[model samples]
Target chain A: MVNKAPLLEIKNLRVHYKVYGGVLKVLDGVNLTVYPGEKVGLVGETGCGKTTTMKTALAILPVPPGVVVGGEILYKGRNLLAMSPRQLSNVRGREMTMIFQDPMAALNPVFNVEQQFTPVLKHAAKNHLSNKEIHAQAVLALQDVALADPERLLQAYPIQLSGGMRQRVCIGMALATRPQLLIADEPGTALDVTIQAQVLRLLNNLVDRLNTSIILITHSLGVVYETVDRLYVMYAGNIVEVAPTRKLFSNPLHPYSQGLMDAVPKLSGGGISQGISGRIPDYSHPPAGCRFHTRCSHVMEICRHQKPPEFEVEEGHKVACYLYGPKNQEAAV
Target chain B: MSEAILEVRDLKKHFVVDHIGTFRRQPVTVRAVDGISFDLQAGETLGLVGESGSGKSTIAYILAGMYRPTQGRIHFRGLDLFSENGKRPLFLKKEIQIVFQDPGSSLNPRRTIAQNLAVPLQIHKPDKNIMRETLRLLELVDLPAIYMYKYPNMLSGGEKQIVAIARALATDPSFMILDEPTSALDVSVQGKVINLLMRLQSDLDLTYLFITHDLSLMRNIATRVAIMYLGKICEISKGSEFFQNPQHPYTQMLLSSIPVVSKDEEKLKPAKMIPTGEIPSPVNIPPGCSFNTRCPKKMDVCFEIDPDFVEISRQHFARCHLFGQTQKQG
Candidate 1:
């Protein structure tokens, strides 16, 4: 799997959202690569730039307010950040698609599901699809999500469906394209655990069947652990750690990553877990060196003045922390 | 263990859904909280967990006296809670409080923390010094009294929730209905809130009907847990045994569906038996055994007759026909 050429590579991606007072440095410098048929989870608390990173890479990040200060988002060797609006449109839906948390809000309330599926069908198809073909494709997509009655559902508006059904419908539209890459931004936030399980299982099955490279962006540790093969932990603009899901969960090297693991309420009957102390750093006036140093338990003098260097501790596992010194240093030690 | 402080029996809340079409309309019934029975003991936290449309929130509302139950009897301290006899006794009103899900919307943005706290204090304890009492409530929740002057908009989401809790405590209620109190908070912030809540409960000897969809959270905090499905209590068990050995098929599914922190733990996975189906609309609940349509263990009896809420084991109750086998032995 590591031998395969990467489908998506976010190299030193930096983003800043200009607010009223000053520029909020949303994403400092994120580096991630997704290979074919890979399930990668991006996790962080709210305001940690997970959404911004995805939007920027997908060329959907609203500009003017959202400015990519540096770095490149290379999708299949082509730089996504450098693409023009017209050029980017070619890859937007067909090559990649993103589903949001809110299904009703993502969908057109006034139009029926059939009408809503029209644009996706048009954009996703390379050449052309007849009205009948489009309708059949939409039905097939809905059926793929295990919808009970796709035909009747296609005729109904977003309001007619339940919350879980609406999300499935959105999933139907997002996947109607057979997208090479699927970016699910907190897709399971609104659904119950059962429905969420269904969604994850569907995604898992679809990925295997279609070889779709997925970047699942969510805050749920369990969702990330179960669905993703590898995961990246983001904190205040930077990706703090990246490792295989099992390894990361079992032994997270980064202090912030460990903090996140500790915060999760476990059903295994452990006492109430202690959350990390201190507030989330203000992005507008982020700390000088490591943004997390303000809250880091084992902060050093160098962590205050200089950024902690990235350390490749294991194969496919990387961490940005002073505790590990720097890349290749641990091996020498 | 302890005398039940609040006893709810055969609770039902139905709302009429008007299906509007250009030409015609049809009236439908949405059975939000139907035939739910549970008892809240003194100084105990009863975690009520269910997905949306499961009537968990509706139960909270009915408990708060916000919505009158279509049918049911709620006994609080051996008195009918919502009787037509009067606008509830002041003591009953003052003894129970509710903290809503969204702390942002629950707290008035225009009002200062002091002003918000004053409203409850003014109504419940007219003779108490408003400013002094507001500060005291803040301190009890581990917040500095300095936050009293700040508006809800200025505070963080967690802080706003703390302020909301402080307001709920202004009346010094024995029972509090916290509806997903920490759902809106960040993971780290959620822990702080949970710790604050636990400390407050122990210090003040408060009873809480904690309504949340977070099962892991319910395991850590609840003394007893009641699982809900389609407005019915499916399983009620001690928190210790609830997750360790879930009886109902739905509960098993719900528990299994919870994403485990590690793939190494195979037991964390849900039983791979239940079919994936959307929770049927409350407006059109199934005829018999509301869960029969999607239940993996559903039988002919389940389709024809609803299962009785039976105790399959000591202090563990489940509403399922499969439990009947154990019920016979028990």
Candidate 2:
């Protein structure tokens, strides 16, 4: 997989939000990459900038408050940050699409399914397809998501459908354009376990069949474990660990990653593990060195003075913690 | 065995809603909690697991005395809860406390942590020093006493939830109804809250009706587990037994469907059983077994006859046609 060029590459992306008192530095040099047809998981807690990274990549971050301090979002070797509005529009919905956490909020309540689908299909078709063609394609897309009655669903309002059904419709609409990359932000987090399982399975199958690369942003490790091939563990405004899904779960290098893994309640009965104690840092005045230094159990003197760089632990696994740095490696030897 | 702390007999909660049909608006009954019974032993966490609109919250509300049951008998420590009531006695209300799902709304925004905790303390134990009790409650939940001066808006989501828990503890209740308490919090904070709850349960010997949709979390914390479908429980068993040997088809489906984090956990899970369809609306629940519409192991009899609860093993009960028929034959 490393031999092929990345489908989407975000390089040293930094984002800040303007607030009443000062600037909130939300994303601090976040680096991520998604290879063609690869399923990547972006795991993080709330306010960790996982959503900010994706929203910035799509060039959709609201600019009055949001400012990209420095970054380049490269898609197919072209920088999206450099693209014009006209050019970006042509690429946005047709080449890359996104689905939000709440299906109800993602969909327009007043508009019926067909009305929503028409614009998306027309956008993909560049206003060339006829109304009948758009209608048929919408049905096919809904069917692709395994919705039982596509024709019936196309006429129904968003409120009429259940949470699971509305999510399925959103997925169908995102996939309708046949984008090369899909960013799903907590797609099944709002649904029940049973329905979530169904929707996730459907997503996995659809993405595999279409050979589309995907970035699944969620806080649940279990969701990512079943879906994504690779995982990126994000902390407050930075990527803390990156590895294959199994490798990361089996042997997490970063203390934060390990804490996150231990935090999830396991099915096999045991006492609930001790979670991380401290809260996420205030973004306006984040810690100078490691943002996690306040909470990290294995904090070192060097960690207090300098930020740790991503050190390759194995072929694909990399961790950004002082414990995994060369100094620790030398001390261990 | 210890005496049952709470006993619910044939509990039911129904709501009438106007169904807007093609021409006329007609009233329809939503059988939210339809004829369910369970016993909560002293110092046990009975994890009530269910999907949305499955009436888990409704059960929580009824137990917390927020919603009166339509037809049921609730006995708290051998006293009928609804029998003599003009309103539930102050003692009864004090004995049973509730912690809601979202702390953001549960805690009063304008009030400080001290003031929030003071409400229960002042009402329940007016003799006690309010300041001392509030600080003690904060210490109980592992929060700093200094936080007592801070408003709900100042605390983080997890901290707010801790404050909520502390407020619930202010009454010194014997039974607590935790309705999806950690669901609204982050994973990291969720673990913290769960640990605190577990510690409190052991230290105080409190019985809990821990309600949540996440079964994996239930596997660790709950002493016993119950699976609720549309308004009714399909299965109930010991936590270990519930995971190892789920009897009802819906239970199996739910167990199989939960996404596990590890390969070993994946291996222990039941064989994947994809349910046929979505949960039917409560207003239009199927005629016989409510789960028949989505049950993978559904038979013709399931569509026609509602199965009664049959004891599968010691303290393990399931309501399903497959088990009912087997129990009858044996």
Candidate 3:
């Protein structure tokens, strides 16, 4: 029987990388849930733990340097963090799949596309499928991504294909297994703009047709806006706010979110966009209270002292900032 | 109307590849920047945009006096660069500066931020009070006074980038070439750097040739833009007009391809993406339109002969047969 449950769920997950300096707290108390057929975006700047969160979901982070300090990552009711090495092999690509950033580096140069895709197909098979059967399925997967001549493409190495073509092949390989959850970490960052759009459309269609859940991690608010139904804004390894895409864009309560929105250069020939005032704080020794207080124009004394609780300002809209409190006026710059 | 600050005339850069040993082969000349010309007006930001190895940066380096052009003339302030008439002016060396893409490598890790800032001042005006000027430059880039003592390794990517910019501004150059200056930065920090660049440009009355692959950011910052392909420009226009009505098929694809935050109602239907093909080597570039290999709207003429860039509307230009044919039909 097909199991019916939330595709994946994370509760108070914290991932830290132990560098020579100290324990770098990359992901601090990250809580997320992905229901089937939902596409959510994890938006943040570089080194904000967006990639780490996705890597942890698939148990891909190397253990020697990186460690999951606490919390649970439940995929189909199974604790992925607690899974043994042997058991994890079964669920990794079959139940949860990931498309990494940097398509060029993600693919191996020596292996052809066929060699890379065959193992996933073999792992998912109920009974032993023939080579012909696998080839047919592979062609269809390539075609789904709008890659013409999939039959010939199967024989080409990753080096032979263009950056966009390689990314399409990677997406096709990931989707071939019909994964319950697809976590794409900046899948379109490296491609040319036109090719990037094509990939986004393909991803959108795949999520719909397969009824697959996806978690898209990117630094681009624009990318998040186009593909995600909801967004979780991460700042300095913390989830500062979570809201529906429309609500977040329309009225961003968090100062960081508002700053990010304002930074987007409007195509209407507006003069210089105002950037966020300060840099991302050092993760090893993050500031007290709200991490954003260092740059927030409407910062309060309380913001520098005590961390604000996540408050539900509206239905499906949550913000973590002291400015939204009952006594304070909603400030804008 | 603004006066042109820098002008490039039919600039071309060709690198000849030699395959030595056994097989005696013909030398291949990589047409990195092939016959491109444009004018940069004073106090205006002109964005040069293209994908990886699209020759956008090549044009930038050429304009910055870093790379000598294989053929063509570059004029700064109506003075011919590298002239034989004793016109080898000092301003050519001091007036133009560059802020490169990667701060990690661009900055010397061994030296302090203040020391890096001192290098330019020493090169241009050594007799002045270097320490005071260095601190002032740091303040202009929005760095704390304390950061002058810190090394590049001690600072963040954003901080290091600020130091690089501060150093570039030390000589008080009239023109700057920022090549992917913020691409390495976080979005939050990227915004800050972009804002800083704009502020400096206005305050100093500087001219910029901004090179990047980010369409949205370029749309935000650039006053005018040139869409580059393999060693050639596919389109050029005033920024807002180009974004609003992109005539070149490649430009349309580039703009529409960017995923953006949108209200639910405004989301466009998924556009038909151009097909992917190898970015044919510059060494042996295809005849006619360089974008035709990957262009979805490619016609028979696109592969046979290069199309002439015509003014479709005020200040807007496109180098595509489709636009050319449409003009003729009209």
Which numbered prediction scores highest in lDDT against the true structure?
Answer: 2
A1-333 per-residue lDDT for model 3 (tens digits)? 124467788888988889897988777788887777888999988777888888888888888689999999998788998889879988887777889888989888999988877887888774387899889889998998889999899999999888888999989988998988889989988877666777887888888899888999888888787778889999887788999887889888888998888777554435545678767888788888888889889888999988787777887777888777665654443
| Candidate 2 residue spans exceeding 4 A from truth | B19-26
Between candidates 2 and 3, the DockQ winner = 2
Predicted candidate 2 versus true structure: per-residue lDDT over A199-300, tens digit per residue: 998999999999999999999999999899999999999999999999999999899999999998888767678788889999999998888999999998
CAPRI-style grade of the A/B interface in model 3: medium
The C-alpha lDDT values of all candidates are 0.88, 0.92, 0.83
Whole-structure CA lDDT of model 1: 0.88
Clashing pairs for model 1 are B256-B270
Q: Give me the displacement of residue B150 in model 3, in angstroms.
A: 1.4
Question: Per-residue error at A6 for model 2, in Å?
Answer: 1.1
Q: Which ten contiguous residues of candidate 1 chain A have the minimum total lDDT?
A: A324-333
- For candidate 1, give the docking quality class from DockQ: medium
lDDT for B73 in candidate 2 is 93
* Top DockQ prediction, candidate number: 2
Instruction: Arrange candidates by TM-score, descending.
Output: 2, 1, 3
